[model samples]
Target: MRLEGRTAVITGGTRGLGRAIAEAFLAEGASVVAAARNPYDIKELADDHEGRLLYQYTDVTDERSVEELMTAACEAYGGVDILVNNAGVSRDGKIARLSVADWNTTLATNLTGVFLCTRAVIGPMTTPGKPAGPGGRIINVSSCVAGRAAVGAGAYSASKAAVEMFTRTSAVELAPKNIRVNCLSPGYIDEGMGKELAANERAWESYRGRLLSDRLGRPEEVGAAAVFLAGGESSYVNGTVVEVNGGLLWAA
Candidate 1:
C-alpha cells in the first residue's frame, strides 16, 4: 500500500468526488476522516471500511469548525498526513446579473473554505513526534472551469482559478516543512455537479464535442489521480495542477 499507515482529512467527503478520494485512500491503507456538514450515507461507507473511516462535521468556511475537524482527525489517528481541500460550492450567474449574495456564498464556500481548512491543518501536519511520515500533502480540488471560459459561470470560474494560485503559493511557503501542495482540476465527471450539468441537453451538447473522449469521466478516475497526489508516487511533485479532464479542447 502506497499510503500505508498514513492519515488523511478530506473536506466535503461525505459524497461525490470527495467520497471517491476517501475510498481510494482507505484502499491504500490510510485512515481517513471525511469532513462535511452532513453525513449523507457515509455511515454505510464506515460500516464497510471498519476502523479506518470516520466522518467529522466540518464547515470549512468556519474557522472554528475547521480547527475542530483537524483536532478530531489527530485524536482519531494520532496525526494527519494529508489534507484535501475539496469542499466547495458553485453559483452560476453571468457577471452582469450576478447577485452580491450569490457571489459571497460562492467565494465563501469555494475559496475561503480552502483557505481555512489548509490553514487549520498546519499545526497537526507539521508538529514533530507525530506519525506523519515524510512530511505532509495538501491537495486542493480545483475544476476545469477554472481555466475554461463559460457563460454564466463567472463566480465559479474565478473561485477555482484563485484556488490554483493559492495552491502554488502554499506549495512554496510550506515546502520547507516538507509539505507538498498540489491542485487536482477535474472536468465533467459522472457525479455531483458534473452529473447535473451533463443532464441538461443544451449544456451537454455545448460541451460534448470539446472532450476528446465521447463520454463524461468516471468518478473513480478522479480518485485515482488523488491517490497519486496523496501518496509517495508524487514525492517530487508540488505546486502543479494535474488535470483529469479527459482531453478538452477550446473551441476555435
Candidate 2:
C-alpha cells in the first residue's frame, strides 16, 4: 500500500471522479474523509471501508464549512497528508445568454471552493511536529476546457483556467512549507459531467473523433493518476497540470 497510514481529505468525494479517487486511495490504505454538501450513497463506501473512510458534510463555498471539514478530518484521522479540491460546478451558456447568477454559481463553487479548501488544509499540513507527513500534497481538479475554448462554456472555462493559475501560484508559495500543489485537468470522460454529455448522441459524435483513444476515458484511469499525485511516486512533481485527456485534440 503506497499510501498506507496517510490521510486524505477529498472535496466532492461522494460521486463521480471524486468517488473514484476515494476508492483508489482507500485501496492504497489511506484514511479518507469524503467531504460534500450531500452524503448521497457514501454510507455504502463507509460500510465497505469502515475505519478508513469518513463522510463529512461540507460546503466548500463556505469558509466555515471548509474549516470544519479540516477539523473533522484531523479529529478522526490525526491529520491530512493530502487534500483534493475536486468539488466543482459547470454552468454552460453563451456569453450573451449566460445569466449573472449562472456565472456567480460557477465561480463560487469551481474557483472559490478550491481556494477555501486549500486554505483550510494549509495549517495542518505545514505545521511542525504534526502527525501528518513532513510534506503534504494538494491536488486541484481542473477541466480540459481550462486550456481550450468551446462555445457555451465561457464561465466554466474561465473559472478552471483561473484554477490552473491558482494552483501554480499556490505551489510556489507553499513550496517552502514542504507542501506541493498540483492540478489535474481532465478531458471529457465517461463519468460525472462527461457522462451527461455522452448521453446526447449528437454531442458525443461531434467530440468523439477528437480523442486519439477513440473511446471515452474510464474513471479508474483518472483515479490511478490521482493516486500517483497523492503518493510518494510524485515526490518530485509539483506545480504542474497533468492532463488526463486521452490525447484530445482541441477543435478550432
RMSD of each: 1.3, 1.4
Q: What root-mean-square deviation over C-alphas does model 1 reach?
A: 1.3
User: How do the residues 24-127 of candidate 2 rate in per-residue lDDT, one tens digit apiece?
Assistant: 99999999999998889999998998899999999999989999999999899888899999999988999999999999999999999999999889887866
Clashes of each: 0, 0
Question: In model 1, where do residues sit more than 4 Å from their true spots?
Answer: 250-252
Candidate 1 lDDT for residue 251? 32
lDDT per residue, candidate 1, 1-252, as tens digits?
A: 888889999999999999999989988899999999999999998999899999999898889999999999989998889999999888888899999999999999999999998898999898877654678999999999898888899999999999999999999999998899999999999998889879999989888888888789999999999999998889999999999988875433
- Looking at model 1, residue 79 earns an lDDT score of 82
lDDT of each: 0.92, 0.92
What local lDDT score does residue 136 receive in model 1, on the 0 to 100 scale?
96
Q: lDDT (0-100) at residue 137 of candidate 1?
A: 96
Task: Give per-residue lDDT, candidate 2, residue 36.
Answer: 95
